[model samples]
Each structure stands twice: as structure tokens, then as C-alpha cells.
Target: MMKKAPTPRTALAPGIAKVLKQLHCPLDVMLMCVRWYVAYGLSLRNLAEMMAEPWIEVHHSTVYRWDMKLLPVLEKAFRLRKRPAGKSWRMDEMHIRVNGEWRYLYRAVDKNGNTVDFLRRAHRDKVAARRYFEKAIEAIDADRETPIKIRRCKYLNNLVEQNFRVIKRRTRPMPGFRNFRCARILLAGIELMPMIAKGQMQCAHGTHPSADDQFYDLVT
Candidate 1:
């Protein structure tokens, strides 16, 4: 007998399969909750209530747990297929309140306003800035042949600063993160939403895939 071909679920990346194996909910439901939480200004409680309207029972805490477990794996998969950003880039940092204290969030966007990457750090110093740059470079998969030009003027950085408002607006509804790790993971998912919107992922069918479609594709 010939060996059978792998079904979609079985063909998933090991990390994705591991996460899906543990969840009792359907894949579409889980992803919809995550996308709404990150892509919109809805709190977890709001999400739970919304799901209840459709008669699909889920708790706010369960949504939180799903975000904690599934987002990182999905993000890793996204990075592998992320498209390269523009040569000219704008970088900036913004303050975010985490656990009653303030923290720095380093973020960047290319000339066309495509997201490069983002990092949450405890401090706002040269060391943290250097680390952010390294992470962005790696995410874009830049090389010497195709040099990246970074511009650092208050006026020039307006692009990325404007982009920060989207994140802030989305987070404004929440009570606030309880710890560093939670803030980091949630923020990563938040940032990923816009990148997908900007058509940053390398879609096989076309350049601009719907946000919902792109998100589902990440897991598959």
C-alpha cells in the first residue's frame, strides 16, 4: 500500500499542532477570538460576551490563555513568511504602562508605512535601542547588498510615531497587563495585525490577502 498524504491538521508545524492539540475549541473560533482581541478595541470580557451571543461558550480567561499559548507559535510561523520591508525606514519608541509602571516599546516602519518590527524593553537606553535594531534587521532579513537606510529626525520619524497610535488605541480598553511577559506577547499579536493589513506577508495567491484570511493562513 502507498503511504497516505498528510491532512492539513497533520501537516501543521509541530509548535502549531502542539497548541491545537491542547485546545478543546475549534480552530476557527479560537483564531477569531484572538484576531478580534488584537485587531479591535475589545476587552476579553467583551469577547466572551460576544461569543455567547453566537451560543459558542468561551470565557475571558480562556481567551487570555489562548492568546498566551497560541500567539507566539503563530508569530514564529509568520516571521518565516514575512516579506522584506522597504530600504528606507523610520524608528521610534513609545511609553506603555505595564503592571502600574511604565515601559518602553521600540517600533519601526518602512517608508511606505509597512511595519518592520517591535520590541518591548524595560529600559530606554542605548543597549535597548541596539537590541531593537538587531531584531528589526533580522526580521526584515536584510543583507549588505540591499542596504537599509535608517533616518532619525523628529520630523522624519513621524510615520512610525503615527503608527504607535493604532496600538495605543487598541490597548486603551484593557485594564492593563499584569506582567512583562503578558504585555510582550499581547503586544506582539497587536503589532502583527497591522503588518498583515499592510500586506506584509508573502501570500501565494496575491499581495493583499484579507486580514482574516492572512491570519488563518499563518496557522495552516
Candidate 2:
């Protein structure tokens, strides 16, 4: 008897598997690693061990490097995704530590609850705020008659604040990221969790995603 071919869910997401396979790991193993970090909010070291089956042997650093290499590819693909059009938006900041120095995260959410933009900066002053606003406003489709107009955006800020609560909770479970790259990559994985949990995205795994709202602990 012939073996049944794997379906789409069991298969890799197009280029992802091929790229990972070329880098020395099997596609299935790579996908498991990716899914673990995206679905569980775990660190690279933790994910490496979690990814290992009882019959297989793997190193934690392997997972770390895999995450680092996979991040840029994920970002590129995510940027190409279509977003719903809108006029009203929100912008806000949340504090994080980069290289042990305080930094700020700037984010924008549209009226439709879609996350519009996410940026990291060293400070959260008016200049940074205005620059973030200008950057987001430019994405609007403006015309000669219907010029883009952004008066004041204070309410939209709440969405980002709410997002920060989720991020902060996850941060508390695993603290001291040791570097910005890890923090940023792990955060990217965490960002995907909300979409799935909030019903905005279909769960990649068979299990349903869960959403939470609470304050957590410090990174340091």
C-alpha cells in the first residue's frame, strides 16, 4: 500500500520549509520550532528543548540561531499582507529595555482594530510622537480633493496600550532577553498570538488561541 501524502497543514508554508531545509534542519523540525515560539511565547533556549522529541537530540543554541534567521523572512512576508483601509487611527508608546537602557515602542492601530504600525525608539517625546504620526499618516491613500487629514489622535492610543499589556505579561514569564535582536524577534512571534487569540486570525495549530489582559513584570 502507498503512504498518504501530507496535507497543507502538515506541510510547510511554501518558501519557509525550503529555506529552513537548506540551512541544515529538516522542514518539519523547523516548522515545529517556529510554531512553538509563535504559539507559546517561549525563549529560544526554552523552545529548542521543547522542540526536541523524546527520541531526538537538539541543542538550544540551534533554536536561537534559527529564530534569528527566520525573523527577517517573517517580517518581509508580513509587510506584504493586505490591510483594511481606514482614516482614523491610534498611536502610543510602551517602555522596554534595550541594552539595559530604557526605550519606547511606538505603535498605531486603525479604527478597524488592525495593528497599523509598530516602531521602537530610545525615547517617547513629542518629536518622536509626531514623527510616528507622520509616518503612519503617509500610508493613507490621499487624493487632490480628499487630502489626508489627521487632527489629533488620542483615543487610538489605547489599542497599543492594550497590546503592551499582553507583551508585558509574556515578558514576565521570561525575563532578561540579553540582546535587542532576541527581544525583537521574540516580540514578533508574540505579536502573531493576538491575531489568532482575538479571532482575527485562524489558529495554525489545532488548539484555540487565548487572549489575556493584565500587567506583568519588568524585563531586567
Among the numbered candidates, top lDDT falls to 1
C-alpha TM-score for every candidate: 0.88, 0.71
lDDT of 2: 0.58
Cα lDDT, all candidates = 0.83, 0.58
Report the C-alpha lDDT of model 1 over 1-220, residue by residue, as the tens digit: 3112224454677887898778887777888888889999998999999999879999899999999998999899889989888777788888888999888888878889998778788877757786668666765555566655454478988889899999999988888888999999999999999888888888887456577778877876
Residue-wise C-alpha lDDT for candidate 2, range 34-99, written one tens digit per residue: 556655657767775665645556687777676677655655454443344356677777777766
Error of 1 at 130 (Å): 3.2
Give me the overall lDDT of model 1: 0.83
What lDDT score is found at residue 8 in candidate 2? Answer: 34
Q: List the residue pairs that clash in candidate 1.
A: none
